[model samples]
Target: MHLNEKVIVITGGGQGLGRAMALFLAEKGATPVLIDMNSQALEETVRLCHEKGVQARAYIANIADEAAVEEVFGNIVRDLGAIHGLINNAGITRDAMFIKAKDGEVSKRMSLEQWQQVINVNLTGVFLCGREAATKMIEGGNEGVIINISSISRAGNMGQSNYSAAKAGVVALTTTWGKELARYGIRTGAIAPGFIATEMVMSMKPEALDKMAASIPAKRLGEPSEIASAVAFILENDYFTGRVIEVDGGLRL
Candidate 1:
């Protein structure tokens, strides 16, 4: 479908892949409704979209909170009249091994707080946003698309039990929602990205980052715009649903 004036809601639209997707969609003539917990960053994203000659609005809300999500989505429906697409792109990681051992004795273990925090934001947040978006689309009789952002680490990465499990669940939700929502004219898909050069990833030591890039077949970190392009493809393709597009530079895990 032509993106002209289409209303697309993007979670975590403040930065990284979310920001890139928002800007790209804006450039394509879509109106992006951006959500982020960081108000300043979200405003900056809105400004950037405006510069692209698109109508974009920013909302500061924690997606994991059911009430907040419900209210924000209600506001969108009230103001925008219909939602054509939604990108469940918000996520966070608290990396830690399930169990840490020292001298054959238990040293530290991944805390419940760490596990719950990641699950709440990464997994539950997606669920909340997806559910609300689907409801709005169905009510509006809008044939819409929902894109979930998974990670290559969903395959089970070391020191990322929580994040891996949550991301894997996201993939499962993408397929399940696709099957259930197809009859309603809503499609669902996922993008499992490899190491992207986001601010958080770039914050690592240069040598470590370079080693990671060397391991990938592409020999370079993927850019946020690459992932944004994948999002556009999914939205534009009507027959694509219930599957994952891995933009991982041939990274196996």
Candidate 2:
């Protein structure tokens, strides 16, 4: 699980938490396969990694597209050799209420498409990537790690029914996959992050961000590097799997 010289796949590696994780892994001498749907952002991440003298590369593909994912992964293996680790980090949030519940209340107004999109990327994508990665790892006899980027919202956010459901599913998948993949010598784990200082959160209204910070016992925004630190911990420890490490400054939601 040492990062040095390991081949790792990081979905949504173009920006946000994914980019930070990729950079940190590369800094530790891991060759990261940066996968994302945004070609431009992917390129930018590669350039940044190169500046840091890390061996990093980018693959442009939509994780929601099965064929695209398979094709891109095939090319990565052909080009980068066997993958030793996978970080299922691609995710999207479509904030909406089940119905027009007053102030993020629960009802049944959420459109089918909204829920489906989040599920496709957050939950199903974990299964797809984990299955594919484990298949290769077993075939290559690689005993490695699989990390899924879950979120505190998995506990149930006020207006994040779809996101919460999908993230919760990811945690379930992490536990399930860990046990199932153990026979193959692969470990699966997840990270549930609290409010971090990603661009998405920074863009929120100042007062809203302040409120979130105040709610956290830490009284501050968690850094992306803190989550990266958690990922490193997960990968480095062999016996820690089929469980989630909540890295949210002690915040439950």
Candidate 3:
């Protein structure tokens, strides 16, 4: 779990929590292999890490594509050697109320497309990446860790049926995988971050944002680095596995 000399693979390592975690890990002497669909964003992160004198590189691929993810992981192993960790941070949101009836228009149906998209990346993508990483780690007969980037919304978000379902599934996988992989000395855990002021959440209405933040005991949104710090803690704590750590500013949703 030590960052030193560790090779970690991160999904959605472009411009949010994943990027922040990758940067922090690199600074700690871990070689982070960042993967994202945004080439320019990934490049920007890689550039910053390099400027900071950290070991890092990037790969651009759609995490939802199983074949592409497998290929990217393979190439990462070839380029970075054995991976000591995997971070499943790639995710997307498609929000729709389970039932909406504002002005009688009554629009609340969650679309098949929305549900499928979120599941493909947030849930299935994590499974694919973690499976590949575990296979490699087991094949090499080494110890490692797998971190799933879950969210507080996993419990259930009012308008984010798809996101909620997908993230909820992620937490389940974290616990199940941790137990299933214990024999191999590979640990698995999850971090559920709340209302972080990333580009995604900051784009919401200021008043809505305030309401969300005020709901939390911290009375402010979390920073991406804060979540990164939690990841670091989990990585270094050898006994922390099969548990979902909440980094949501005391917010319980």
Tens digit per residue, CA lDDT, model 1, 29-115: 999999998988998899999999989988888999999999999999999899999999999989999999988999999999999
Off by over 4 Å in 2: 101-108
TM-score of each: 0.98, 0.95, 0.95
TM-score-sorted candidate list, best first: 1, 2, 3
lDDT of 3 at 90: 90
lDDT agreement of model 1 with the native? 0.94
Residue 252 in candidate 3 has what lDDT? 83
TM-score of 1: 0.98
Distance (Å) between predicted and true CA of 74, model 2?
A: 0.9
CA lDDT, candidate 2, residue 104: 72
Best prediction by TM-score: 1
What C-alpha lDDT do the candidate models reach, one value each? 0.94, 0.88, 0.89
Considering every candidate listed, which one attains the maximal lDDT?
1
**Each candidate: RMSD:** 0.9, 2.3, 1.7
